[model samples]
Target: MSRIARCSCGRLTVRCLGEPSRISLCHCHACQRRTGSAFGIAIFFARARVAVDGVYSTFTREAESGFLVSSHFCGACGSTVWWEPARMPDWIGIAYGAFAGTELPPPDQQVHVKQRLDWIRLDIPEK
Candidate 1:
């Protein structure tokens, strides 16, 4: 079955068919800023495996990987649905928060641990 994720107002939704290639936690400063939180979880799937609906906006920014990342967000609630990172041009990144569940799988790996908040700690190793 496909996993469906939607914006808070239900104006925007994304459908991901099948399992994701990977899921990870990003502790980079940019992620913290984008999520307005300590870290962000990214569930990745091939670009072609996902479908999106409704009008959205894009914001392009350079990631620590030195690639332009274009994020697509809902125009109504400003919730980010997915992002296309230049590093992985063929993949779609679905924010974990977009999912409609609280007991989602834990991130398999963590990235940018050096930039993680000093008080934030996880037993997972940076990959």
Candidate 2:
């Protein structure tokens, strides 16, 4: 299946050509800060199966795992659309919220469980 994830202004977009390789709910503090929410859902796809378009800017940071992550956002609307992690050289992570108008699979797993908010509970396995 093909899915298009776009920025709020509809300028930047990532086109995913098939089912995502994995989807996870991330509860790390960085994720919380980035999303301005309790957590962030990351939808991952193989680099070969994804295509990005539109003018964008990137912010690169070191992840908790010690690898650098480059997050791409729409230049016009400042919405984060996707990211590339040094730890996962061949996969790109898209913000699940960017695919706003479509139905997506529930998160396959949860990460940084120890950092998860006490009020949040999910049936998915933790990693």
Candidate 3:
């Protein structure tokens, strides 16, 4: 069965057609600014297997690598749904918060640790 995740507003639902390749905790400054948190959780999936429903809006930012990263969110509630990297056109990273009733495993990796807030301590090693 496909995994379905919806925005808090319930207006947007994303169907993930297969298991995620991995889950990550991103400490990138852009992610911190977007989420207004210490880190952002992302579930990686093959772009071909993911489908989104309902109207949504996206804000794009250029990554440090110079690739564009498009972040999708529910227009009504401003809840983030997913993101896609322009360079990795075949992959989609769904926001972990979208999985309302599901429990997320601990992040398998942490990226951009250098950008992490000094007050937040990440003792776990990245897988």
Q: In terms of lDDT, which candidate is strongest?
A: 2
Tens-digit lDDT track of model 2 for 11-120: 99899998999999999999999999999999999999999889999999999999999999998999999999999999999999999989999999999999999999
Please give the TM-score that candidate 1 achieves against the real structure.
Answer: 0.95
Error of 3 at 110 (Å): 0.2
Listed in order, each prediction's TM-score against the native is 0.95, 0.98, 0.90
**What are the runs in model 1 whose C-alpha is more than 4 Å off?**
none
Whole-model lDDT per candidate: 0.90, 0.96, 0.86
Worst 10 residues of 2 by lDDT: 118-127
Candidate 3 per-residue lDDT over residues 53-117, each given as its tens digit: 99999999899889999989999998989999899899999988788787566777888888878
TM-score of structure candidate 2:
0.98
lDDT of 1 by residue, 11-122 (tens): 9999998888999999998888889999999999998999999999999998888889999999999999899999998899999999967456778999998888889879
In model 2, pairs of residues that clash are none
In the order shown, the candidates' Cα RMSDs to the true structure are 1.1, 0.6, 1.6
Between prediction 2 and prediction 3, the one with superior TM-score is 2
Q: Model 3 off-target regions past 4 Å?
A: none
Residue 116 lDDT, candidate 2, scale 0-100 = 94
> By TM-score, highest first, what's the ranking?
2, 1, 3
